[model samples]
Target: MVHKFAIEQGALIEQLPEFIQSHFNMVIDVKADGPCGYHVVAHSLGRGEELEFYSKEYTFSNIHQTLGSIYPTPSEPVGTKHWMSMPSMVEAIANAFESPVFFFSPNLFSIMLPSLLSAQSNSRNIYCISTKYTPFCVLNDEPYEFPAPRYLKNWEKSATKEALGWAQLYSPNFQKAHD
Candidate 1:
């Protein structure tokens, strides 16, 4: 069976694509904390949102790797939380979990954010999530139960390399992490 990557709703809800908005009525909402994205990741992983410092470190490194030319690539401080998000955070979550993430954002499909799916690195592998044309909010189980508003049931399939294949199928730039 095919598994999905579910995001906790805040700003992402408004952005769901036609494919998802028509099929599923579920929408999970993580706490409105600084690390809500992390919360979504943690929830999917069957753990709490509190993670290691490497998560922050990994996120920043990817940002530099991907966008260093366009933005100031200094090692200066960056925040842990997000208003909506900063790029490569998805990549960070993918690395931290050792799982493949899937994006539900329409931006990638529309080319609003072209490199939105790029792994942001051409050198070493970055095991970030994949991109979907439609929208955000999804994942699987040891019978992992999603949070309120949906309480969706899924399995822990996203953690495997197989899930990575699924992500790659939908994600255009997934090769950056592999190739």
Candidate 2:
């Protein structure tokens, strides 16, 4: 849905990796108010921009921890406004949906799931890209996707070790590759 907080995504579209540009057509800007990462997932699922994992009883599984190691408190409680929810909420959704969730940041990314083997067989996978504000872009293609990136951004190129560390936080799979 169109809104004031959506990203313009003009020239930035051209700068995307050739693989991404080839796989999906750039859609309209997703509202950047807050939970835009969730929005992308919902869209990928063909459910439009609505993700309602909260306001239900099942989403509170071991989620009383910090977000990304810096936030003082845990993610917001249920029934909060759409734009007020945090990105980590996707963790609960991924668990509930029994799928893997990818946190795609500017220079780093993370693959989070309860079990790598189980998530690999999941029918529904999630990808969220953290932009300057929130996750505004969604990559929803298969076959062309690779585990280790052939080309990374300038920031990631200089810090491959650091980037792999960020990925290892959620998946021991990264540990094997790094080792």
The candidate maximizing lDDT is 2
lDDT of 2 by residue, 32-111 (tens): 64545545666655566643432232354444232222222234423334342335565555555555565555565555
Please identify model 1 stretches exceeding 4 Å from their true place.
1-14, 22-25, 48-86, 109-179
Assess every candidate by TM-score: 0.36, 0.48
Model 1: per-residue Cα lDDT over 19-134, one tens digit each: 33333334444443343454455555545444453355355656434332322214432344323263345544555545444444445321111122332222121111223322
Global lDDT scores for all candidate models: 0.35, 0.46
**TM-score of model 2 relative to the true fold?**
0.48
